[model samples]
Target: MFGLFKKKSEKQKLQEAYQKKMSEAHKVSHSNRTQADKLMAEAEEIAKKIDQLKV
Candidate 1:
């Protein structure tokens, strides 16, 4: 596919990472509240970076 030749931009990479962190946080929430909170915080930080990149 032509997509293979393309690289992700910084914003795209950060967004993907944020989504992944949120999903992990959701999955961990039930078994480990503390870890899930940590993941959520990380996702928040990533979200901030994504916002900064948008400007």
Candidate 2:
């Protein structure tokens, strides 16, 4: 009867998106915080962008 089930809540969607973005960012080869931050920013608009990754 309920074929049209509701989708994930806003919070869930945001969290999922955040995690996915972070994962993608981490996979990339970033030299410094300046670049890393930019990649991370793509995931969460509110989170501060990291310039470079420590790794």
Candidate 3:
């Protein structure tokens, strides 16, 4: 499909990154609180950027 060749937009990329980070955080949460928290913080920053792009 043509979609396969298309590049993702900045916001879309950020959203994917955010989702990935959140999932990673969730997986890490059970084992390491500190690492999970760090991942969550990074995810929040990405979410902020995605929000900024919407405005």
Among all windows of 10 consecutive residues in model 1, the one with the lowest summed lDDT is 46-55
What Cα-based lDDT does every candidate model obtain? Answer: 0.96, 0.61, 0.97
Candidates ranked, most accurate by lDDT first: 3, 1, 2
Give per-model TM-scores.
0.94, 0.52, 0.96
For residues 14-42, write the lDDT of model 2, one tens digit per residue. Answer: 66777877876776635466666776877
Which has the higher TM-score value, candidate number 2 or candidate number 3? 3
Model 3: CA > 4 A from native: none
Cα lDDT for residue 34, candidate 2 = 63
What is residue 36's positional error in candidate 1, in angstroms? 0.4
| Model 2 misplacement above 4 A | 1-6, 30-35, 46-55
Question: Order the candidates by TM-score, highest first — what do you get?
Answer: 3, 1, 2
In model 2, residue pairs whose N, Cα or C atoms come closer than 3 Å (at least 3 residues apart or on different chains), thus clashing, are: 32-52, 33-51, 33-52, 34-51, 34-52, 37-50
- Candidate 1 local Cα displacement, residue 3, angstroms: 2.0
